[model samples]
Target chain A: MPAPQKHVIGLVFYPGMTSLDMVGPHQVFGALPGVELHRIWKTLAPITCDDGLVIVPDTTFSTCPPLDVICVGGGLEQRAVVDDPEVLDFFHKQGKTARFITSVCSGAEFLAKAGLLEGYRAATHWGMREQLMTNQGVEIVNERVVVDRNRITGGGVTAGIDFGLTVASILCGEETAKMIQLLLEYDPAPPFDAGSPEKAGPELVEKAIALMQQMSSLEFANPVR
Target chain B: MPAPQKHVIGLVFYPGMTSLDMVGPHQVFGALPGVELHRIWKTLAPITCDDGLVIVPDTTFSTCPPLDVICVGGGLEQRAVVDDPEVLDFFHKQGKTARFITSVCSGAEFLAKAGLLEGYRAATHWGMREQLMTNQGVEIVNERVVVDRNRITGGGVTAGIDFGLTVASILCGEETAKMIQLLLEYDPAPPFDAGSPEKAGPELVEKAIALMQQMSSLEFANPVR
Candidate 1:
C-alpha cells in the first residue's frame, strides 16, 4: 500500500481574509503527494473572503484535528482576528501542540498578540512593520520570510505562498517543495515593477496608503490590548 | 463624488472547478479599488475546490446581477462546465451581456463548446489544447494569454492571474493594473527551471508525460461528447 500520509496542514480562514493569503499557499501545499490540506474556521459554513470570494471550511475551529502546521492569514478584518479571544486562545493552544506555527501578513500580529512571537524573529506586511516593532520581545525582520525556531512568518499577502513553500521544504524535504514549485511554475512575471512600497513609485504608494487610511484608523482604534 | 465605484466583477464557481484557475485571478482582481468581486454559483451554499479548499458563493446563479465582466474557470469537471445546459445558457447569455467574456485553462473549452469561441483566438491549459481544437472556429494559441476582441483566455491555472491583470488593464486602464501589480510585487521566483514542457528538462518532461499517460484512459472514457 502507498506510504501513509505523514503530515497534515491546517489553514485557518476568517471573514475578510485575503484570498491570496490562503490560495497561494494552498496551491503549494495541496500539490504534495502525502499531504492533506484542511481549511479551518469558526464554522464549517462558507466564509467570505475580503474581496467577496466565499470559501467553506473543511473543519470548524472546534473540530480541527491535531495539526502538523497551522497558518493564519490577515486582511481588512484583522481587527476581528486581533480581538477575538476565542481565536487567540485557539492559536495559543494550537501553537503549543503543532510542530510549526505560521502567519502571513498581519496574521503575525495576531500571533504576536497571543504571546506566541515573544523572543522570536518575525516578518509581516510592510504596512504593519511599525506595529510589529512596538511589540515586546519580538524581533521584526524586513525579509520576505523569517524563520525563527519553529515559527515561520511572511510579509503581506502574496508572500504567504513563498512562506508556505519554505515551510513545506523544512517539513517534507526540499525535493517535495521543488516538485510542487515546478508543477505550479511558481515563477511569476509582473508586467509592472511595483509590488513593494520601495519599488512602487512614490505616487502609487501614496495611492495605496490613501486607500488604506480608513482601514488603518480602524486598526488603531481597535488595537489588541 | 468619487468616480462612482467603477464596476463589479462576478466570477462563477462550481464543484470540482480547479481552485487555482479562480483563486489565482481572484488575487489580482480582488485587490483593486472601485471594483467589487463576487463569487456566484447555482446556490449561495459552499462548494469544494478540486483540491479540497471549500468556498462560498456570494450569489446564487439566479441572483447574480448584470456583470461588467464574468470569468468561468475549468478543470477535471469540464464535462459539467460544457454540458450543463443551464450553465451553458448562463454563459451564453452572460457572454453577450458582460463587457468581457474570459476563461482560464480548460475554461476555454467551455466557451468553445457554448459556441462562444466561434471566430475567436483563444488559449487554454496545455493539457486540454487538443480537446479545444476539435471545436470548429476556435483558434487555439500557445501563448500564456490570448486576447481576441472581447474574449480573453489564459493558458492554465497559474496563467489566470496574468490574464486577470491583462483584462484589468483593458477594463480599468493600464494604470490601474500596473498599480495593483506593484502592490502585489508580482515578481515570482521559481526554484526549479522546469515550468513548461519545453523548458522542463527532458528527463522531467518524460516523467510528466508518464504521469499524463496514466490519466489518458480516464480522459478518453470521460470525453465530453
Candidate 2:
C-alpha cells in the first residue's frame, strides 16, 4: 500500500470567526484524498460564525492531536485572540511543532503578534494592512496570498480558499490539488465588474468605508489591537 | 428607523450533503446586510457533509421559522431526500411560504420530487442532468444558473455561490449585492483549465471517472441516487 497519508490539517474555529475564511479553505482541503481535516476550536459546543452560521468542531483544542498544518482564520474575534494569553501560547507552542503554519485575513495579525510572523513576509485583509504593519519585523505583501518559508498568508476572507488550494498543492501533489479544483468547479463570475480594491472605484471603496464606519461603535467595543 | 431589516434565508442542510454546496451559498448570503441565514436541518445534532465536514444547525425541522427564500443544496444526500416523505412535505410547505425557492446541483432533483419544479425551468449539476430532466413539467436548462418565476437553480456545487449572489441581488438590490461582492473580491482564477463538463476535456473527465470508479464500492455504499 502507498505510504499512509501523514498530513492532518488542524483548523481553529472560535466564536465570531469569519465563516468563509474557515469554510472556504475547509472545502478545498477536505476534498483531498488520504488527508484528514480537523476542526479545532476551544470548545465542543457549537460555535457561530461572524455572520451567524453555526458549526460544531471535530475536536476541541484540549483533545486535538499534533497537526501537520495549523490554520487560524480571522474576523471580529481577533480582539479576544490578541488579548488572550492562552490563545497566544497555544499558537506559539503548537506552531513550533507544526510543519506549516498558516493564517487567513487578520489571522496573520494574530500570528504576527504571537511572534510567529517575525521577520516573515505575510499577507492580510487590505483593511488591516496598516495595523499589521505596526508589528515589527513583519513584511506585508499586497497580493491574494503570500507563502514565505512554511508560513502561508492570504488576503482578506475569501482569499483563504485560494490559499488553501495552494497549500494543499504544496503538501500533496499539484495533480491532486488540480483534481479537487475541477471537482468543485471553482471558476467564478461576479455579475458586477467590481471585486478588487482597484476594480471597485474610489467612490465605491469610499462608500464601503462609510458603511463600515457606521459600525465603528461596535468596532471600538472589540478592537483587535 | 429604517424598517428593522428582516430578510430571512432558510438554508436546507441534510445528511450526506456536499458541505461546499450549501457553504458556498451560505458565505454569500450570510454576507448580506440585514439578512438572517438559517441552517435548517432535519435534526438538531450536527450533520456531516459528504467528506466528513460536520455542521450544526440554527434550527431544526420542527422549529424553523418562515423564510423569505429557501435554498436546497445537493450532494450524496439526494437519495435520502428523494425518498423521505417528511422532507418532501417540509419542502412543499416551505416553498409555498418562501418568496423564492432555489436549488443547487442535484438539489433540483429534490425540488422536482416535491412537485415544486413543475412548469419551471431548472438547472442541475451536469452529472445529474438526466435525473433532473426526467421530472415531469421541468424544463432542464444547460446554463450555470436558471431563474424561472420564483424558482431558481444552479449547476453543481460551486455554482451555488453565484446563484446565491444573484438571488441576493434580486431580493435586496443590485447595489447591495455588488457592494458585498466587491467587499469579498469575488473574482476567481483556478490554476487548471477544467471545471465544467465542457471545459474539462474528455480525457480529464475520463480520468476523473476512473478515479471515482476506484472508489465505486464506497460510492455505492453511500450512493446519492
Candidate 3:
C-alpha cells in the first residue's frame, strides 16, 4: 500500500502585499492532512507586508515545485506586482498545470495580468474592480468567492477564509472542509454590518475610498459595482 | 504642535502558534495611524507557525518597548507555551502597564497561566474550555469577543478578526474602524453554518475534537459550556 500523495500548494508572496489575504488562506490550507504549503517568492528574502509585519518565504520561484494550488493575495502594491514580468512569468508558467489558480483581493489583478483569468469570471477587492475590469476578456464578478472552472477568486482580504474552505471542499471533501472550519472555530461574528459598500452607506464608502487612496497613489476611487 | 504618540502593540509569537490568530489582529492594528505593532518572541529568529508558515519577529522579550496592547494568539502548542517561564515572565512584566492585555483562543490560557486573567471574564477557543475553567479565579465566557475591563479575549482562531475590530474601535473610534473594515472588505460569508459546536452538531464536533487532539497530545475533549 502506498501513502497518500501530498498536495503541494504554493502561495505567492511579495513586498507590501496584505498579510491577512495570504495568511487567511494559508492557515486554512495548513490545516489539511498531507497538504504541503509553500510560501513562494521571487527570492528567499524576507517580505514585509503592507501592515509592517514581515514574513520569510520558504521557496523561491526558481525552486518552487509544480503545485496543486497556486494562490496570490492582494495589497496596495497590486499595480507594482502586475508590471513585474518575473512574477507574471512565474504565474504563467505555473498556471499551465496547477490544479487550481486562485487569488484573494487584488491578487486577481496579477492573475489577470498574467493572462490566466482571461475569459474567466472572477472576483477581487471592491476597490480594484474598476482597474481589474480593464483586462481584456475577463469578467469580474461582485461575489465573495467565485469559482469558474479551475480558477477560484475571493473578494478582498477576509474572503480568503471563505475561498480557502471552498477550495478545501473541492480538493478534499465537504466533510473535511467542514471539520477544518469547526477546528478553527470559524463561526464569524463581525461586530459591524458595514462589510460592503452598500452596507457601509455613502459616508463610509467615501471614507474607505479616501483611506485607500491615502494608502497609495493608486487611482482607486472605485464605486460599488 | 506635538506629534501624536504612537500606540505600541506587541503580539507574542511562539513556534507552532497559529499565524491567523496573530495576523488577523496585526493587520487591523497595522491599518491604524500612529500605531506600532511588534511581533515579539524570546529571540529574533524566524518562528514557524503550526501551519508551516514562517514569520520573522522584529522584537525580543528583552527589547520590546512599553506597549499599549499586548496580545497572545492560541495554537496546539498552548500547553507548552504556558509552561514556558520565559514567555510567562514577559507577559507578567508587560501586562503590568499595558493598557489592554488580550488573547484569542487558547491564548487565554497563557494569560491565565501568567496570573493576568484572575477574576476576569474572558473568551477562548471552544475546545479548551474544560482546561481553562480549571484556572483559578478566571471565568470563561462563551462569546466571540469578551471585554472585561482592560482584558479582552476572543473565542478560538477566526474570532481574532472580530476581536481586532473591537479593539480598533475602542482605540481609534468606530468611524476609523469602519473604514478599515471596508478596506479589508471584511464582510464574511461562510459557506457552511457549522462554525460552533452546537451549529456543527454532534458528529462534526467529535471529528473536530479528534482532529485537534491528533494535532498534539493535548487533553482537549472540552464540551461547550
Candidate 4:
C-alpha cells in the first residue's frame, strides 16, 4: 500500500518575526498526520526573532515546494516586510494557488501587501489593526481568528493556537482536530485578565502601546534584516 | 550609572521535545525588561522539535552561565532525557543556585528525576500524570499552573503561556506582566473544549491516547538521541 498524500504547509520566515506567532500554528499543523511543514525563508541561514530566539529555516524561496497552506507571522518589521518586493513576490507566487493563505498578528499586513486580503474581512493583532486598515479593500475585524473564503488571520501573538486549531479542523475533521487539541492540552487558564486593551484598562493599554514604541525604537534603529 | 542586573533564564532543549512547550514561556520571558533568555542544549546544533520546528540552542551545558530561572519543556524524549547522565548533571549544576526551577508539561518529569520536584506539589501534562507519580515524594497537581515554593510546573503545552505570565509577574511585577500579557494579546478563545480528557469525552480521549501511541511507536523505533 502507498503512503497517504501529504499536506504541505509553508510558514514564511523573516528576521524580527515573533516566535510565538509562528510556533503556535506550527505546533498545531505539524501534529497532523501526513502533514509536511516547511519553514521557508529567503535563505537557510538562521533567523533571529524579535525576542532573541533563533530559528533555522528548512526551505528557501528557490527550493520551496508547492504548499497547501502558506502562513506568515508578524513583528515590528511588518512595514519593512511589506515593502520587500522579494517577499511579496514569493507570497504572490505561492498564495495564488494555495488552498489557504494565513497570517498571525501583523502577518496580515504582509498578506495584504501581496494583495491577498483585498476585499477580504480579516483579523489581526489589535495593535496592528490601524496599520492593517491602511491597505485598501481589506476590512479588519477584531476577532481572535477570522476566516473568509481561504484567507485566515489570527489576532496578536497567542491567537495563533486558536487560528491553527481552526485551520486544522478545516483541513482534517473536527475529530482529528479535537484529538490534536487534547494532545496539546489546549485548555487555557490565564492568571491575569489583562489580555486586551479593554480588559487591561486605559493605563495598561497606554503602557503596552508605549512599550511597543520603545521596543521598536530601541531594537529597530537599524532593523536586522 | 550601572545597568540593572539581568534576570538570566535557561530553557533546556533536547531532540523530540515539543516546540510549543518551550516557545510559550520563552516568548513571555523574552518580552520582559532586563531578562536574558538562554536556549541551552548539549550542542550548538539545531534541535528539531517533535513538530518539525528547528531551533538552535544559544548556549551549551558546559558554557551556560548562572541562571536566575531554570526551565525544562516536555516531550516524548523525557524518559531518555531523564536517563542521560550528562543532562542530569547539567540540570543539577544549574538547579543548585537557580532562584527558580520550573517545568512545562512532561518537562516536570525531568526536574523530578533531577530531584528538583521532591516533596513539592507540581503540575504536568494530564497524560503524563500517572507516569510522573512514580517519582516518590512529588505531588502531581492537576492544575493549569502549579506553584510550590520556587518550583513551578505548567499543565501542558498551551499552559506554558499562563505559566510564563505567572512567572513574569513574580519576577517583575503585576503591572509589567500585565503589560506583557496585553502586548501578546493572550485572550484565548479555543474553538472546542476538548483540551482535557474530561472535556474531550471518553471516545475522543481514547483516540488521542491511541494517536500518541502510534506516534511514539512509529517515530521512536530507535528514538533520536
Best by lDDT: 3
Residue range with the least summed lDDT across 10 consecutive positions in model 4 chain B: B216-225
Q: Rate the local accuracy (lDDT) of all candidates.
A: 0.74, 0.76, 0.89, 0.87
Full-model lDDT, candidate 3: 0.89
DockQ of the candidate models in sequence? 0.45, 0.55, 0.86, 0.84
On residues A1-225, what C-alpha lDDT tens digit does candidate 3 reach at each position? 576467999999999899999999998899887898899998998998889889999899999999999999998766677788899899999999999999999899889988999999999988878878886678998899999999999998999999999999898889888888988889999888888887888888887888788887556655653
Model 1 C-alpha lDDT per residue in residues B88-114, reported as the tens digit of each score: 888877878888888987788778877
Give the runs in model 4 whose Cα sits over 4 Å from its true position. Answer: A1-5, A217-225, B1-5, B217-225
Interface RMSD of each: 2.1, 1.7, 0.7, 0.6
lDDT of 1 by residue, A1-225 (tens): 878467888888888787887787887787666787788888776677776777778787788888999898887777766778998888888888999999988788778888999999998776677777788579888778888999998877778767877887887776566555544544455556666766766777666655565544423211111
Where model 2 places Cα greater than 4 Å from the true spot, the runs are: A1-4, A213-225, B210-225
**What is the C-alpha lDDT profile of model 4 across B61-91, one tens digit per residue?**
9899999999999886555666799999988
- Classify candidate 2 by CAPRI docking class: medium
Total colliding residue pairs, candidate 2: 0
Clashing pairs in 4: none
TM-score of chain B of each: 0.89, 0.90, 0.96, 0.93
Q: In terms of DockQ, which candidate is stronger, 2 or 4?
A: 4
**Proportion of native contacts present in model 4:** 0.89
